[model samples]
Target: MNGCCYGRPTRLPWGVSFPPSSFAGLEFGNAKIHPSQLYFSLAGLVVFAFVWAVRKRTGPAGTLFWISTMLYALVRIPLDFTRAYEPETAFLSAFGIEIVESQLSSLAIALFSLLMIMRLRRESLAPSAA
Candidate 1:
């Protein structure tokens, strides 16, 4: 998680080109971009800190995980727009989709957040005597 949140964004500029060669036709320039990985890493750290603060205040089981996941999803969804992506890549074209790594990560985080939320709700509703 930290690698994805910190490394990808920073390392990409050294060699990785956006809109990759697969989409050579697309207009792409070698512009020094922001270090998004660092941003994501900081975001993760903030979420971690928030979760740590709320761990005792929140309920049991997956509460922290769910909340963190939701926060990550929310942040990633918008970050996707800022990151470069190749719309013509096999991964994107496979399902007639146009999504980048950030978008995919956001989707996964959202799904996990939903699942955790449901689990937390279920646990809360269960009989205490059981």
Candidate 2:
């Protein structure tokens, strides 16, 4: 979320002040954008561990995939919250309320996965006694 995707162009305090090609065309001098670098790389490892733990609990095979996706999104919400906002597309204004699109999307993804997991777990636990 902090690359060319949507993060705002920022001026870094620790850098040489020069008009590089990437920043030359930009409006502000020395305002650097993320250089296609990694954001929270450790998050992937954490998600892997979470999925592994859940799988070891006898979770359904696909539950591992679902939990992985859900946990990643859950982490994204906070990451985006602290991230630099995109100058143009950071927030949506509607009904007199301003909301961050990234946060909303992350939240939606997390909720969807949680509901799916719960439904699958409930079904799996149901008895055939009738």
Candidate 3:
């Protein structure tokens, strides 16, 4: 059987409510946060497009994968900046770290890019002297 029968209903809870609000007048405290999940999903699709475009380019087997992942991370980081985050409290910690979303994303991209470059280099060198 499909999983839907076993799952709960998908509608929002009946008691929850929201006042009519516009994007411009909404403050961080009063406004609903931007949907970061949907943003990331769109970013993923963009990355897929990029990978598909680059797949046939002459370079390495895994280059497109790495590039796509890096770009996705880069996009997500900046997008996260526009989102609302909960206030830090004694019970809640953002891992005790204070990194801008873009910075973190860039770092991840850099590391993955480096790994891809190294892997490509090794692959290219493998059959050269044989």
Candidate 4:
């Protein structure tokens, strides 16, 4: 998908050009668009670096996984805004906030992972039952 941004010309790997009418009213017309795939790839590398760096310092057994998951979602939530996507057709769209399906899924995953991390931390810190 193409995102609107003013920059140097983008070279599509497919080596094909679309006419102005090719894209359903998007009007790309050989215009440069944000390289969303590259951005996502870079974000993934960054997330991996951060998670790997802190792996040994996590609070509990499952905390690292949850932390990494939440971190990825946090990154994805903002990253999705940079990409062109269909807005969710729900009641929230009525409020004028354009949220995509990926963003919604990321938000849910982030929240759930956070809750799990907190629960794991609490369990790790509680008195031992043994």
Candidate 5:
């Protein structure tokens, strides 16, 4: 079910394309993906390496997955600001502060991953069963 989850359509001089029927959802009638997706993809790889290195220093533990997620959110939210967005994109709000849905979702993911990492660190530091 890979619907149009890229969040926004791209308007670059050289953008991407999808078969009209291939995409089940397209409010903008554009065939290309957001140009920022390129940035996100490349940054994602860098973040993966960074998270891997950090996890190695931290411990060969279960928190790498959580760490990766947090790092990805850190990478995405900022880039999203520069991405071209259509009018129909869903948004999330807090106390009259309105933010794009994906950005807010990224924040939530980062927070949760941070919590998981902290909890896991605490557990790892605790004394093992005798």
Candidate 6:
């Protein structure tokens, strides 16, 4: 499952072959692919650590949520390129760059998070009516 869930199958560069039972779902004929799930897990840990580290320094409540959302999108947009995904019928393309469904969703989430962060920040800064 995890192996097949993400990333395209990669062929061995030096013509290396493994027994089909060697890695179970990790092998395809004579090639091993990028462990995209592991990559994603590692990236998630990194994001968590970074956000946790900065939590105390970040101003206002909910800032970390927005920051983390943006961070995930930033990493995922590039990371998804390494994975194999079905061609989207409703994707956006421009200047030779295509945005797939997952990427588009990430973008929307990040943008919405940013807007909410800004709104919250503005609210936090405004003088309170005693």
Top of the candidates by lDDT: 6
- Among all windows of 10 consecutive residues in model 2, the one with the lowest summed lDDT is 1-10
Per-residue error for 102 in candidate 5, Å, reads: 0.7
Writing each residue's lDDT as its tens digit, candidate 4 over 11-121 gives 655323344554422445566555566677888899899989998998889898898899889998887655554334332464556776777899999999999999999
Scored against the true structure, residue 93 in model 6 reaches a CA lDDT of: 73
Candidate 4 wrongly placed segments (more than 4 Å): 1-27, 87-97
List the pairs of residues colliding in candidate 1: none
* Clash count list over all predictions: 0, 0, 0, 0, 0, 0
Count backbone overlaps in model 3. Answer: 0
Across 31-105, the per-residue lDDT of candidate 2 in tens digits comes to: 554322234456778888877776778465567777888889988776563344444755776674445787788
Model 3 lDDT, residue 104, Cα: 66
State each model's C-alpha RMSD to the native: 7.1, 4.8, 10.1, 5.9, 4.6, 4.1
Worst window of 10 by summed lDDT in candidate 1: 1-10
Task: Tell me how far the alpha carbon of residue 47 in candidate 3 is from the true structure, in angstroms, after superposition.
Answer: 0.9
The TM-scores, one per candidate, come to 0.59, 0.65, 0.55, 0.73, 0.65, 0.75
lDDT of each: 0.61, 0.61, 0.54, 0.70, 0.70, 0.72
Pick by lDDT: 2 or 5, better one = 5
Top candidate (TM-score): 6
List candidate 5 segments past 4 Å from native. 1-34, 90-98
Considering TM-score, which of the candidate structures 1 and 6 is the better prediction for this target? 6
Global fold similarity of model 4 (TM-score): 0.73
* lDDT, candidate 5, 53-123, per-residue tens: 77667653778888888889978888777454554664855574446778888999999989999999999
When 2 and 3 are scored with TM-score, the better candidate is 2
Q: TM-score of predicted model 5?
A: 0.65
